[model samples]
Target: MAAVAPARRRKRRSVPIGRMLLLGFFLVFVLWPLYWMFNTSIKPSDDYLTVPPVWFPTEPTLVHYKAALFAYRGLDGLINSLIISLSATVLSALLGTLMAYSLARYNTGGQHLSFWVLSQRFLPPIGIVLPVFLIYRGVGLYDTHIGLIIAYTVFT
Candidate 1:
């Protein structure tokens, strides 16, 4: 029998060291701020304003968290945010479904009407802010939960 020829090995391509170094530098630059924020939160107040920044806290404390949730009423604000967001989401979904169904089944207002309605979404919030604020104020809904829910639902 004839001797089999030796099998050839494939050469694997290697990544450039310079490109890897550049990507690593960008990764650190983007993540450094997030790391600093977390580090600062856990650090003692005295270490916050030190000339040389504290990379690691010797004694981590939860006093800031406790103060935010209790003393500053952060818990109440969180609850209010949840309520407003949920209410607005539900209302918007319900109204949008009804409108879409009507448009599809009945072709309410003609073919262009759907386009007109969708165009409203592209309008900048800044343009309507003053008008909505004025209307809310005039209707005595300013600073109320219901008003915020309505505003969010409409904008969304």
Candidate 2:
């Protein structure tokens, strides 16, 4: 015999089990809570205390939303919240843009400033909540719309 030719094989072209598992994990973790919250929000008041915990609501109603929006004056609260949040967001965006431009062009505050600002993200929100609450109370900022705007701006 002179020589023999080997046969070639095609790839399976299939997704790995690990990748599917990871995707499934993300889907469940991210979407399940949101689904449950919306489902619960539309459910009847009795659904809350029901035994076995209704996964899918049997009876859904918008009475709670209507009551809150009209009877409890939630619309006014919503409007106030929107104004405060929008103002804070706009202020932060403008200030952040200016600061970043200055830092990039003039190297303002030297190199350490960037690191210090970045380090704020690492601090736990829970750790500062009590202090912030106390300070807001002492300064008469607590339970005020302006307080919300200030608090949101600081975090931004």
Say which candidate scores most in lDDT.
Answer: 1
Report the C-alpha lDDT of model 1 over 23-56, residue by residue, as the tens digit: 9999999999999988899899999999888789
Best by TM-score: 1
TM-score of each: 0.80, 0.58
- Off by more than 4 A, model 1: 1-13
**Candidate 2, run of 10 with poorest lDDT:** 2-11
Error of 1 at 146 (Å): 0.9
lDDT of 2 by residue, 15-129 (tens): 9999999999999999998998888889999898788998888778998899989999999989997899899999889988988888788967878998998899898888899
Provide the RMSD of all predictions against the true structure, rounded to 1 decimal. Answer: 3.9, 6.6
Instruction: Tell me the lDDT of model 2 at 126.
Output: 82
List of clashing residue pairs for candidate 1: none
